[model samples]
Target: MKLIDITNNHPKLVNEQLSNTDAQMVKVYSLGQTTVIYTIAPTHKDLVIINPKRPIRDNEIDYVLQRTIKAPLQSLEVTHVGNFVEITQSLKKKRPTFVPRFS
Candidate 1:
């Protein structure tokens, strides 16, 4: 996915993009590296999440599963809904143990 494409097609992602909060480092799997994207929360400022490494492939998804089982960060799916792109974290399964939980 190209940055221009994302920006043009999915304005929501770019509009909601945010900088990393908290000093702690978070490990996330690459979805499709093109550029950064963002989302708007009901409350608080927009949140930005990193795009998966460029050229998302089956192998990359496999690598994410393998590594995540060992160490996981919250996983989110980026999808386009009509004219807007939405970023949603999957609740299908538990996040990796290494992932920090908010109290």
Candidate 2:
């Protein structure tokens, strides 16, 4: 999914779109090369968002999000969000962690 680079433009429109939908909670999934976000709103369809540019690293996630969403990550009241590595690890845990030993 191609994310329109709104860091330099259209920040207001994007904000309005998100706000109008009343989607405050979002679930995020990170594939190897990109990230996917699902906005949860009972009144509207879940908004699936990919990245705006290249895959954002954990260290720079805050900066990238601030630029793209035009709001500081802290102020977004974001909690219970999982990053790529975290989700991946959790998935791994749920699967059977056994190796076949053919004698």
Candidate 3:
């Protein structure tokens, strides 16, 4: 599936929404000491519903973490609904890999 790297300033509302839909918080990579890579679960069945004003439920967070650890790469699809944005996971083509060579 296509891997989409999440940005650092992706709005706390978005993150909160992810938490609501059971979006597991995977690996967090430090980038330039400011940015981080937050990987989530990859399952076609899993979905992350976003609500800007509403807070994420606790049970959803637990379910997300449980499923994320078991999956490989997480799939996320972003869509805007009203004033909220939904991030859902779906089956997509595998992402490409890049290897750097030393000079």
Candidate 4:
């Protein structure tokens, strides 16, 4: 039997793309050569599609979400395509309880 640890081997994101309009907003983060699209709808949950402009690992999806989204995700749904993956997470919007006052 052979086992491998692949959690720490994914590429890190170096840049991001933000698009905003009246209809909806889109956020795209690029990890090295791979690109992942993350969309959050006001009426629905957030969606993350890993189309992988290049090769991408599954754990990288988690990394992107952790870095981008401030809200904790709930009811996660992950779908694996031929060579990519899609992740859906319902975000509970919460107002920040603490506001720092810089003097």
lDDT per prediction? 0.36, 0.42, 0.42, 0.51
The superposed Cα distance between candidate 1 and the true structure at residue 16, in angstroms, equals 16
For all predicted structures, in order, the TM-scores are 0.24, 0.27, 0.22, 0.49
List the candidates ranked by TM-score, beginning with the highest.
4, 2, 1, 3
Candidate 4 per-residue lDDT over residues 1-103, each given as its tens digit: 1122222343232122223322144555556555555555654444444444544465666676576554443456767665576666554667769988999
Q: For candidate 1, what is the lDDT? A: 0.36
Report RMSD (Å) for each prediction in the order shown. 11.9, 16.0, 15.1, 9.9
| Candidate order (lDDT) | 4, 2, 3, 1
Model 1 spans > 4 angstroms off = 1-24, 28-54, 69-103
lDDT of 3 at 32: 26
Cα lDDT tens digits for candidate 3, 1-103 = 1223454446574577467755455333221222223344544443343334454444433344344434433334544454333344564657879999999
User: Residue 47, candidate 2: how far off, in angstroms?
Assistant: 8.5
Q: How many clashes show up per model?
A: 9, 0, 4, 0
Q: Show pairs that collide, candidate 1.
A: 13-38, 16-38, 16-39, 17-38, 18-48, 30-52, 30-53, 31-52, 33-53
Best by lDDT: 4
As a TM-score, model 2 comes out at 0.27
Give the clash count for model 1.
9
